[model samples]
Target: MEARLETEVCVIGGGPAGAALALRLARLGHAVCVVERHAFPRSHVGESLTPGVWPLLDALGVVDEVRRGGFLPALESLVCWEEPTGRRVRGRAGEPGLLVDRGRFDALLLGAAASAGVRVLQPAVAQRPERTADGWELPVLHEGRRLVVSARFLADASGRTACLGGRKQMVSARTLALYGYWRGDTPHGPETRVEAGPDGWYWGAHLPDGTFNAMAFVDPELLRERGIGRRTLESFYRELLGRSSLLEAWTAPRLVGSVLACDATCYRDTVPIERDRIKVGEASFSIDPLSSSGVQKALQTALSGAVAVHTLLARPEHAEAALRFYTEDQRSSAEQHAAWAAGYYRDARSYQERPFWKRRALAPAAVAPLEVRPPLSEDGLSHRRWRLASDAALVDTPCIVGDVIELRRAVSHPRLGRPVAYLEGVELAPLVDWLGQVPGEGLTMPQLADSWARRMPFRRSVAIMGWLYRQGLLTEVTADGPR
Candidate 1:
């Protein structure tokens, strides 16, 4: 005697990731349902965001609404990480980002999703997720009732708890965040203030509501005995606040509330995708908040994840490939972000000896020269499997080298930050037209490189061939030796 609901997709956790996905998929004419454990306008942190988020929100048709929400603009950061005595201020006033009231921002998005034909259930807790042949059956608790939602796909947009991880915890740095809100002048006006101290680091930003939000990032062990309680947390927050000149400017500013704590560590989910279920947003992985990319990362993951899910449900034949791409890309993006944040810890010479900093400053993985295996030679025939990925519709971007309109398209990939080209900067796809119509046999990587060697040396062609192979653009085809 249980109530039941059915849909094409049931997304768990109605945060930005879940809501955004539900909105997009529903707009695509799919029956999507989003289940959330918390009610709207719930307390959540992470106000500071990256500028890159504007375009993503625009794509979702929410940018105009978000802009009119009167969120505080964040243009630059005032950093004090130089340790002994160093200060750096960087901001882009014209290209400023916003500091949001997280509760409100999240509520707006969820509401937008609901209005966009996405069925969102509030105060709903998801029980164990069971995978089915067609998709998944998610048992959800709402309004003192157990409801079963049957869907063709299940998405876990749960936050760092990553409900989808389902007891198989991924290895992650267990850094704890202790933060509080205050009514006073923040260290830097409107701009954020970041500094490194004994235990870990501190972040402070002026909220749009004429209040300030300050958070301390440190090892959980550092908070032993003197951490959670109201009095103890206030003392801990004060001790760390006193270390910063920014906080000292305030003379007994009124404390707004109790100090809240949560895990802010960087980690990735190693759980493989199963059945028709996938994880998006923090449910997939999380990184250090030091990068101030928490929200932006969630949006990016959601965007890509939507594409992946759509591909899987719409075109089952490509499910394997699409899902594979989604998982690998999400994991790699997390790894790269972790590596990027580690450098900040390592750069602070003042805390190199501190146990907290020392542990975080572990030597980053050394970058090796980009190389390809099974070598390339001119006499070999190069083969390809996947179509070339590019932003340009055709070889449209014109590049001039020695007086010729050598047009090329921008090759793009999730792992790469910018467009890439091979052999004298020509788009790899257009230059390989002859490979399909070779006279005798197929063209090897080197031959492809040589044909386009008009702007590159022979040795350089070899390198380009290897590069293309590494990018999975050119097939090795070295099995039968030059046939």
Candidate 2:
């Protein structure tokens, strides 16, 4: 007999993204069921987490658990990209990142989700889903037993598998990552290491379990061109590592596991979110591995995705805002990361002539050249008169308001990347509107700031004013006219 389960939200996959989403939804009083193919404590890649992940974890109420999980703190990094010689880069004190054993890290999150009243079906394979009048119905196989799950909303956090199945829009050159774990005497400090090679780049890091992971990212075409097959894959991976100065620190390293290869190219799902379904983490988009923030980005998507899903379920009137907010957020994040990766690739002087570097170093065409402006000294700020730029205006934008997505009036300018809804938790539309109401003759920086200070903090008003000037949203008033 087949078992049946019903939930407000059905999340596929039990990795960080799925688990985080399930946990958050359950905490929000929504019935969430998660179907995962793998059991707990399964081996996975992308172990490094950036410092930015702390706030998200804290928000998820998993900070204490993560701290006690025995993960290594990534206090420093050794890099040899721009120059041949490696240099040590240290993060801020008491706020280092983490080098995690992904297996345990993922399990910890899944366990948290289960403890939070989320129904978890581990070792379950979710089959194709069927759209229903209300939501979706999916068939799942669990431990030789067939089960059916019906949900009001569907969430795909299945990483690159993308169980929801949509066409992916490639954002970067096709690339492959070949990697393996090794056990050996510590030849280098606990810092993560990165080096740019002639044809590709190398990354190596020490995990908390005393195992070192070394990886090589290169063009997939290179493998076919060199006729690298399963029989010669290990040898070829070693040969590539031998050319690396940074990873060479592993003395007498013994391969603890077989060399594995997977696609690492950046891409985004053409449709990441809809009214009844949503995709988070790598299912929505994947960024370059150069930033070492894949796990961080996944968790970010989960947090935001949870809110989006909640709004879609509980506040039907805000469905459009919720969908638009999540879609725009995903696109913006992917594009920004792509641009950042290209800039970093261009900085690698060692491999500028190589095909891998040359292909990735080119910046995206959508990035506009930033307008350079002279710094405004305090004396100059008080002396010059200013008025709102002609192009600056208030536009309606979808923004996250507390728990639900809402349309808010935001300041818009060509110089700004997107509409600015808020800054440092202060609503910007009101401030921009007040600035517009100023006399055409304009006011000195101090005069305008003093008048605005009556409404808010003096420092906050000045900060917003400075941002306007920096973004060219405010223009100078000259003897002739506005400049």
TM-score for predicted model 1 compared with the true structure:
0.77
lDDT of 1 at 426: 46
Please give the RMSD of candidate 2 to the true structure. 1.3
Q: How many clashing pairs per prediction, in order?
A: 5, 0
Lowest summed lDDT across 10 adjacent residues in model 1 is found at 385-394
For model 2, give the 10-residue run with minimal summed lDDT: 362-371
lDDT by residue (157-255, candidate 1, tens digit) is 998777777533333457988888888543435668888887788898888787888888988878774544656777877787777755643456667
How far residue 381's Cα lies from its native spot in candidate 2, in Å, is: 3.0
Per residue, candidate 2 scores C-alpha lDDT tens digits across 1-483 of 668898889999999999999999999999999999998799899999989899989988999999999999999889998999989999987778999999999999999999999999999999999999988999999989999999999999999999999989999999899999888776667889998998889999999888889999999999999999999999999999889865565767889879999999999998999999999999999999999999989998999999999899999899999999999999989998999999999999877988999999875844566588777675566668998999999998998888888899999988777899998788989888888988888899888889887778999888888888889988888888898
lDDT of 2 at 322: 94
